[model samples]
Each structure stands twice: as structure tokens, then as C-alpha cells.
Target chain A: MASPEIEELTQALSRLPGLGPRSARRAVLHLLKKRESALEPLLRALDAVNERLVTCSLCGNVDTVDPCGICADPRRDARALCVVEDVADLWALDKSRLFPGRFHVLGGRLSALEGVRPEDLSIDALVARVEAGGIDEVVLAMNATLEGQTTAHYLAERLERFPVRLTQLAHGVPVGGELDYLDEGTLAQALRARRPLG
Target chain B: MASPEIEELTQALSRLPGLGPRSARRAVLHLLKKRESALEPLLRALDAVNERLVTCSLCGNVDTVDPCGICADPRRDARALCVVEDVADLWALDKSRLFPGRFHVLGGRLSALEGVRPEDLSIDALVARVEAGGIDEVVLAMNATLEGQTTAHYLAERLERFPVRLTQLAHGVPVGGELDYLDEGTLAQALRARRPLG
Candidate 1:
């Protein structure tokens, strides 16, 4: 019923995460209605990102610059390196303003089912960065998933010979979580890793 | 944590309907990761739609052409016209392929609460089209909302003197609707307009 161009636009929008065909159509209509405000700005932003964005050589994070803003920032603690399964994870951690350190994106977790091996990830680069020596701590901030834990274990074994101290994010009940609603595994982990109140 | 350009992109994406900040961030990450397959195609589609799409002067429908594909088609029943509240509604009705007639978009319904008046819509243009003659029936396919009904009544009064026959969509229980789950208003309408056995 819509023009081919409009249909194509809707199809393209539906490819985005969390947006289905019905909502994509609505979004397209909204874009068409507010062409100057929504459509034009989005176009400009996409063009700028597509043209200027590049993956960091030192870390796998994406940024407008090659080294990335986080990697190049002198204020960050260069001694502490955070290893994550993906750039999204890196962004999520950095957005909190905690974790005052540089990041190394592992590209993906080690998944035996999916055939994702150690070489498929940026594990070699991570080890090389740790081996180069100034990093005092390597924090494995991989997700709590089984594959993520496997990847962290593999990285720890490879970096054990290095001078850097290895650590991983603690598994426990989340902040503001209700005890009744949490899974049994989380409850057990929280109990095992209990800390004394200050 | 993200570059200025990526942040701007996420902000722009968040402006879309049905998408919030977190989902928009995820969408941006997906786009950046699949730049060749997803991002470029979306950009190209948006650019094409922005450059070529236009609202039909005759029917108020949006398309790449002046009269729109429906209006330009000689196979459509020009004698029967379907009046809708918005272009989206027109596209939706047309997508079903159930409405064989051409459509006239009123841009929006008459909402006194929202300060939307008859003059604010394409009512005058619609009246002009009906006055041009040859139309036999005008289907008032407005939404079931109070504002939509009010607009339909106003349009009916305006087009009363025209040679065209005015009609409206039948109000009743929707297809596949269970009586237990339906609202009182719909149940009443369905009972009142209940069809006799063949």
C-alpha cells in the first residue's frame, strides 16, 4: 500500500534489535511526518558514524578514532585492564563511570556449541597487552553465562605466567534485587561470597 | 563512554517510536557491527525515501508520485472513495486489499480537546473532490475513537448535499474475538447488529 521506497525503509528499520515489522512501519510514518527533525538528523548521524567510525587497534572497541577515546584517555588507569566479551559490554561498564581502566574487547566468548574457539576471539591481543607489562590487574568482566565463564577461564590460564594479577566479577544477588525473586544459583553464590558489613 | 557521534546516533534512534535509550544503544551497536549489511542499506533506503517521496496533492496520500499509485491506477474503483483519518490508516486499509476504492486522508481527526478543528484538516480539499462529481459512494472508514466518530459526523453533514451515498464501517465484535474477553461496548454493538442465520 505504501511506496516501494517507504516499504524498503520500513524493512530496513525492522532489522534493528527490538523493532518488529509493525513498529518499524510506525517508526517510518513518524520519520516521514517529522522529516526535518527526526529523519534528517538520523541520516546525518548515521552518515557521520559510518564515515568516521573505526575499531581501535589496541582494543576492539569502536570509536570515531582508531585508538578510541577510552584507550587514549590519559586520566584512565592504564595499569588496570578490563576484558569484556564484546564492545557492548565495554560500553555498558564504562557508562557507569566506575571501572577506572582501559578495556579490551574479546570480540566473542568461547562457545563449544557455536564452534567459537580461543583463536576466534582477540585472546592473543589481550595476552600480548598483559605481557607488555605495565598492567597490574586484568579484570575479566565477562557475562555470567557458561560460555563467558569458559572464556574467562581460558584467558586466566594463558595470562597466569604474566606479572599481572587476575580477577573476575563477583557472582551475587544484584543491587536492589529481592531475595525471593532471585534464582537458586544466585542465592547460593551470594551466600558463598558474603562480605562482612563495614 | 561512547564517542560523540555514536552517542548522537543513539539519541536519534531513541527518538523513534517503540524504542527507548537502552534499546537504541543496542540498535546502534548492531548497526556498527553490521555496517555493510544493515547500516548502509538503511541509510540508502532513508535517503531514497527522503529524496523521492511526496504527498499526493489529490488524495493527501504519501508516495513517490504526484497522484500516488492508487489514484493513478485506472483499475481502481474511482466511483467509490474511502475517507481515512491519516495516511497510515490508508496504507493499512489498502494493505488488506479489501478496499477497492481510492482513499482520501484527512491528515487527522477532529479533536476538540487537542484543539484540532475541521479547518486544520484536509476537509475542504475532500469536499472539493466530492463536488467535482462522478463519485457514487463515500465510505467513512474513521477509527472507532470518539474523535474519529465526531469527524465522521462532521464530514457526513458537509457531504450530505452531494450526489454520493455516505456509508460507514459496521461496528461489532472483531474477528476471532471471544465474548468473555470483550468490552461491554463492543458486546452491546455486536448483539445489536447480530446477523440472522442463513
Candidate 2:
């Protein structure tokens, strides 16, 4: 009989972005071996995140509290908004320390094949936030994929009439680059977004 | 002014194998996003493991309870012992289901420069267990590193006086191949251990 515990562990690990069955098995074995030092802490971290972390009500980024540390911080620039595909992308941009603005996590891009539409993203909420008046510029940091481009275009059209400036994160994002692969999509977007830099 | 919480998290994550500062940051971000899905469960698992796990007095393998299941199981063959460098090696052997014997975890190899002497390993205990009688074989499954080889040679010599059979894991470990890199080192060992197909 296949042990359900192992099967569950394998399945759980396999769901990770890069891990597969073999790697999952290896990781599980590592945990089993170093139970006290490695496994215990990992499990604790997992539980803590599950029990305590909440999504920011405004931007959809994860945080220990609603609205997240970034969104809640009054020191951050409210006039600028950085849009990202996922929480991981937000973190990537955060590490660069280039953006003092708040973030909006779209969760994913607009994909016809995947049935992900603009409504499927956080764009509607983003548009509403922008129309509320304080946000001076909305930077489209969505990926360069077909779906990302489509989502960005949709958002651009929706935000066109707003008093705020509408700008797409620029050409620095490689043809196939994902936000995870780009360091500070904010800075790259800023440089490429400069007026008449051409 | 370092936030103690950030410090705690950073230190905890850095302790994980292969996780450097960059990886740890990325991991923390990822955990923050999927807090409920991964973080909470991981935290609970960690606490459970830490609170419940203990080292097997016999083999030094980690388990939720003392005298780990393998060591307590009467069905296992005590006569045939598998000597491995780390508990991870023990798990690999167990997963293969090829060896029904008990195990001895050396904790680490004999690295003279690293000051890991023979006594530092559980070699003495292994020798004592073998000398106590009833043991049919002692298979040295230490890593194929220079230190591992040195340790194995030392064990082979120490156990030579005993009536028990003395054998190693059999080489052909593909020089640079780490134990984790091998799908199943037990299988690889068995194959390399085979004496002429004929």
C-alpha cells in the first residue's frame, strides 16, 4: 500500500514553482533526516504564515495584517502605484529599494487560453483606487507576455480618462522576461519610461 | 535599527540548506504571499516536529519519538548493519527497500583537517555493536569524498578482527555525484556492488 503521507508530501511539494516529484522526494527526505533542525522550523514557518498572514485589502499583497506594511505605511508615496503580476513580483521590486510607492498585485495576467481576463486581475480595483484622486501615476509593471500586454492595454484604456498620468512599465522587460526574472522592474520601467529618451 | 522580527526570520531561513540571503529573501516573500497555503502549515509542522522529534539513541536518526521506529522495529535484521555518513543516507537506503538491516549514522566523516576524528563518528559504537556478536555484515555507505574514503578505510581495518563480514558501498559513484544527486544510492551501490554479470 502506498503511504498516503508520502504521497501527500510529494503532491504538496510538487505544486511549488520549480519542484517536481524527484525533487519533492529529495526535499522530504532532507526534512525527515534533519527533523529537529530543518523540518521543525520549516513547518513552523509554514504554519505561522498560514495562521497570521493576510492579504492587503487595497493591493492584494500578503501581509501579517490587512493592507500590508507597505500599503499601510504613511511614509510611502501615495501618488505613485506599481503594478505587478504576483506577490513575488512585488517583493522583487521591493528589494531594489527604487520605488517608494504602493503596489497592486494582479494575481496573474490576462490569458485567453487560461481564461484570465482583465476582470480576473486586480485592474478594476486599481482603476477605482486611481479614480479616487490621490494616485498621480499608474505604472503598468505587468509582464511582457501576450496576456500581460493585453491586460496592460486594457488597464491603459480604462485609466485614460482619469486625471492621473497613465504609463506602462517600459521596453526594458525582455520579450520573454517574467517579473520574477527582472530586478527592479520599477527602475527599468522608470528609465525606459523617461520622456523622449528615444 | 534592525527589526527583531526581520532578523529572526532572516536567521531562521538562512539556516536551511542551500538557502543564502537572496534565496531566503525570495522564500520569505513567497511565504508571505501564500501564507495560508504554505506558511501556516509549515509553521505547525515545524512546531510539531520540534516538540515531538528526538534522535534515535541507537542510530542518531531523527523521529517524532525516541528509539526511532527503525531502531525499535524487531522485524529489522540487526545482523546486517548499514553504516551511513548521515541520516539522509539512511533514508535513501530505506526508501529503496533493498536492505532490511539496521543502520548506523556516522554524523559525519573523518576529516582530519576539520578535526573530525574517528571517535567523532559513531564508529566505536558500530565496532562495539559488531563485536557484541550476531552481526553478519557491516556495509560502509559513507560519502565517496576523500574524508569519507578515509573513514571507510579506518572502519574496514577496525572491524577486520570481528567475525562479521566487512564490505563498503562499492564505488563508481561517478566522481562528482553527490548522494542526493543519485536517484537511489542504494540501487546504485547494489549495481556497482554486483560481482560480474556472469
Candidate 3:
């Protein structure tokens, strides 16, 4: 039989997203083969992340430091704060290079079926940031899913006490989207938000 | 944008066999979410592997202890040794729990296209193990692929001078395999090695 250590490593690896038992075994084998190049560095990186990463005090974003790089950067528009569903969504928006503002991460969207509540997310921290002033606009950059919409509506109502103009990602045909392939909801949104010709 | 640590961790995770950039990011986020339960333990496991794991001098298996557990076990049938193409293969066979004998891991198969020579693999070590005596039979448990076949043939010829008996895995339709779905070569082998009806 395979040694318990090998089995343990494989089981741990299988817990990763997109990896199953078979694939985990393969990955473990690959790591053993390239122990110096892949495995050791990965171990070091994991240790660094586990030891150094912390939640940003201002926006609840995962950061190596207290405020995280984005929240701490002075060059970003402090007046515009983009709210996202998760750190992954925040990273995706940042990768697009479209939004040039700070971000606030709400741990997860509201899901009552799964027994998730508003208090389960970082909504209180977000509200605290908005109440502190200086933000001229709050952009709700949550996903288009039902839970995301519910979370967005809830946030819009909650942030009404502040003097900031609240907005959300417009529902319309995405960039490079084809009309025929577009869903009915997107088509309707595009028609409703249609602008006058120049 | 993600911190340098997050980016580095993501990049390192993406190098794993089944994980890609997007999945790696998700994995990093997952680890961050379950730092105490999952991430810390994983880091500890990797550290242990990095600091403790070594190649078994006798069997070429990756082990936390020298000579590995299987090689050190005195109860195993040393007379019947199973030889495999890689540590992955060895682990797979070990998982099957069918073979009760010891093992010899051939780091990789002899591949001509990849410029992999016999000397590049652990074939020499295997020969040395066989020549040391007490091993009455050597089961060539290599893959059925071209390179695996070439390596097996080479080993078979090389071991002809030794007193130990050599045997390769039997070829036929796999268990639960349908004859119509089976390949011609497998069908041919099944016909050639047909046994009397029970």
C-alpha cells in the first residue's frame, strides 16, 4: 500500500477546487518529481500567505497588510468606492482595469435558503466606511445572480442614510456581445437604457 | 488588485497539474477562508514533505524515511518484486492492494523521442537490486504505451542473464470491458491467451 504520508498529501490536495482524488494523486506525484522547483516554493508561498495576509480594516479585503494595497493606495479615487461580492470578484474587476477606485468586499451574497444572513457578511464594515464620509459615489459591482441582486438592493437601502450617490452595474449587452445570442433580460435592459444617437 | 503574496501564491498553485490561473485564485481564496482548519494543516504537510521526504535508496520511492516503509518492512515477500514505470505507477499498484511483494520504482520509462535513455531512469538500480539475489521473480508492471513497452522489453532482455524469473503484465480486454468496444490488439491478445471455460 502507498505510505500514509503520500495518501495524506493526496487527500489534502484533493480538497482544492477543480481537483479530484485521481487528479490530486497526479498533482502530488508531479510535486514529488519537481520537489525543488514546484513543491518547496509552493510550501513557502502558502506559509507566507497564511502568516502575512490579513483582512483590510477599511474594506474587508484580504490584504498582506492592514489596509491592503488597493485601499492604501492614495492614487485611487477615494470618492468612488466599488462594492463586490467577494475577493475573487474584486480581483476580476481589478484585472479588467476598468474601475479606478477602491473596493469593499462583502464576504458573500445573501442566501436565506442556505441559512445565510446579512450579519454573516461584512455589510457592517461597509456601512461604517460609507458613514465615515468622503465617498461621493458607491458602485455596487455584485454579480447578476438572484442572490447578488438581493444583496445589492439591501445595500442600496442600507446606504441611503449617507449622502453618496449609489449606482450598480448596468444590465445590458456585454462588450462584444451579439444581439441574437443575448438573453431576454439583457435585451430588455439594453432597450431600456438605449441612448440618443449623436 | 491582489497583493504580491496572493499573486505569487496563485501563480504557484496554477503550476499544479489540474489547476489553472482562475482555479488557482479560487483555491487561494478558499485557503484564506479556512486558514485555521485547512490552510495551516496544508502548509504543515508540505513543510513536512519538503523537510522529511527522501528518495528510498533501495526502491526509488519518495519517503519520509530512508529505504521507505515498504523496503524496511520485513514481512513483505522480498522474493517477488514488482517493478513500475514511475512513483505514480507504484502508488497506483499499491492502492490496488493486490500485490503482496516488495516494489522497485523506475523513475520513468525509456523514451526515445524525449531523448530519455535507459541510464536516465532507475534501471541500473533495478538491475543491481535483482543481482543482489533473493528476488526469485520480477513483475514488469509498466504501462502499455509505446515507451512503456520499449522500457519493459529492454529490462526483459537485460534481466535474461540473471537467475530470477521475469514476467510482464498480461494483455487482454480489461475487467468489465465489452468485446465490441475493445481495441483490435486487446481482442487479439484475449483470443491468443484464451482459457478453458469454467
Candidate 4:
């Protein structure tokens, strides 16, 4: 089909989150077509991130700077530390602009079956950060999945030595989610955490 | 939140097919995680493709070499020419290894509504390619869409001046397509082109 180089490119692109073989080929062709505006800039950008980007020592977030955007922001409440399962979750919360605080990425959850233990995550470092003081609250903003809950519960017990207040995202139907489509667990939680309506 | 460089990379990657903003960010993170295996190799491959690859003068196919792999292959059937709408189509046909012929990329189809005239495509070069040589057959392997059909018809009429046989791909229920899901036009075509069991 294509040359060895193009095939190599397609192979690399297929490793990405959503792209597969066919879509990788399409992406290569597209990049070739839009060489200057899209491809060149993307190449430069990828190289830049690869060369300069490093994880923030304080929060485990990837950034060019040492402290990352969130950790460095003075306006964000340092006392309100948001704990997430991964970097993607951190970004999602950041995009919403609701959580006016810093973050500590666990790297992953405590999945014993998958061999992901507390040591494998940033639990030690996070506890140390909380133990160092000044953090008034710890937001356990993990997904409502089994792994997420397990990780959250484990962290709560581990961080019991610290005085930080712990909280988790409410389990319920998503904002745009219909009740019919929601699972029974979410319905039950929503019912239990019933709030007064306007 | 991520730094400026990660954001820039995400923005660029989001432009690629199959990647939105969130997926692009995920891809960046994945690359960061698999820096040695996926990221570095991809960067090198992309740069290699950008620096070296060029379109074949004879066939309009993209390749690192001057005449492209297909055009340069001595064993290929030079007399059998397959015409397609774009490089992507050419690659698709080539990947199957079913078409042992050379290719001529039309760049695009004739769209009167979009003001894409015959000149807008590489129709002149294609006509010249057919007019000059000993091409036994011309396979119009365009898509089974209105635009593809229109271009094929126009090319057929134009190539009527030459002594080559012009053909098109058969329209039928795809190999894995279910009978229940097939439309009337396809069903009629399949019935009309039905082959007897040997």
C-alpha cells in the first residue's frame, strides 16, 4: 500500500487512544495533505512536549514547569487538594472550572487483580503532602467505578493521620443523562442524596 | 491543568481524524507514558515522511522515491491502469494487493455545485497517461456515491476516444453485509449480477 515510512507512521499513530489501522492511515494522508498548517505545527508541538514536559513534583501533573499550572496558580486554594485517579480526570475537572483547588494524580487506582497497589500509586507522596500541613481539605474526585471507590476508601484510611477533610463526587445521573439510561446504583445514590429543589 | 506545551500538542492532535479535544489530550498523555516505544518512534517517522516523501511524477502516488513503489515496480502490469479519486483511494486498492496495476490519482471528482471543474482535478494528466501508452484496461475504482459516479461517467466519455476498456467496481451487498440490512438498489444490482454455482 504505502512505503515503509508511511506504514511505520500509521503503526505509531494506531497506538494512540482512539486511532486504529484505517483511521491511522486516514490521519497520515490528512497530515500529508495539510502539510504546513496542520502537520508541521503538530510535529513541532509533539517534539516540544516530548522534550520539555515533565511531571509536576508537587501534584504528579505533567507540565513544562516544575509545579504545573494548577499547583503554581496562587488564586487556586492550596488547602483544597483534589485527588484524582489519573491525569485525564484532573484535566476534566480543570476544564469545568468548578474546582478552585490543586490536584494530586494517583497515576492509577488500587486494582489488586491488575497488580495496582497503593505503592504503585502516589498514595505515599499524597499523604506526605497532606501531612506537611496547610491543606485544609482533600477532594476525592475519583470516578464512581469499583476501582475508583476502592482507591478512594483506601486513601481515606491511609490519610486518617492528616486533619484534611475528605469528599467524593456525588453518585447520581449525569447532568444531561436521562433517568431511564442510568443504572440502578446511580438511581439509589441519587435517591439517598436527594436535595431540595428550587 | 496541563502546561502550555501539552495544551499546544493537544490542540494540534485534535485536528487529526478520530481525535477530539479530550481524546487528543489522552493521546498526549499516552505518548508521555510510552515515550520510548510509541512517542520517539512516531516523531522520527513523521519527520522522515515530511523530509523525504514526494508525489510520483508518472502516477501522482506519494512515495519516498521519485516514481513511487507501484510506478517503479517492473513486475506490475503497466497496461492495467486503476484510476481513483485521491491518494487515500490509491493506497486502499494497493493495500489489498488485488490490483497489480499502476494508479493515476484524480485529486478529486467533478462537482459542479462546488465549482470543481475538470481542470480542478488532474484529469488532463490522466488523459495524457491513457493517450500515450499501451494500457489494456482502465479500472474506475471510484466510490459508490453520486460524486464518484459522476466523475467515472465523465472520465468514461472522455476516454471513449482511446482503445482501452473502461470498467467499474461491481455494486453489490458487501462480503460481510447482511441481506436484511441491504437496500433495494444494491439488492437489484446483486440479483442482476448473480453468478451461477459451478
Task: Tell me candidate 2's fraction of native contacts, as a decimal between 0 and 1.
Answer: 0.19
Q: In model 3, what are the clashing residue pairs, if there are any?
A: none
The candidate, 3 or 4, that scores higher on TM-score is 3
Question: Which candidate should be chosen as best, given lDDT against the real structure?
Answer: 1
DockQ of prediction 3: 0.68
Question: Residues B1-198, candidate 2, lDDT per residue (tens digit)?
Answer: 112343456566666555566666665666565656855554544455456666778887767657778888899998999899986678778888899988898888889799988877788888888889999998988887878888889999999999988887655556676666666755576577768766
Which 10-residue window in model 3 chain A sums to the lowest lDDT?
A1-10
| DockQ score for model 1 | 0.81
Give the interface RMSD values of the models in order: 0.9, 4.7, 1.3, 1.5
> After aligning candidate 1 to the native by TM-score, how far in Å is the CA of B113 from where it should be?
4.8
DockQ of each: 0.81, 0.21, 0.68, 0.69
What is the TM-score of model 3 when looking only at chain B?
A: 0.90
Worst 10 residues of 1 chain B by lDDT: B171-180
Candidate number that wins on DockQ, 1 or 2 = 1
lDDT of 3 at B178: 94
Quote the lDDT for A82 in model 3: 97
Candidate achieving higher DockQ, 2 or 3: 3
Off by over 4 Å in 4: A74-76, A96-98, A172-181, A196-198, B112-115, B172-181
iRMSD value for model 4: 1.5
Which candidate number has the best DockQ?
Answer: 1
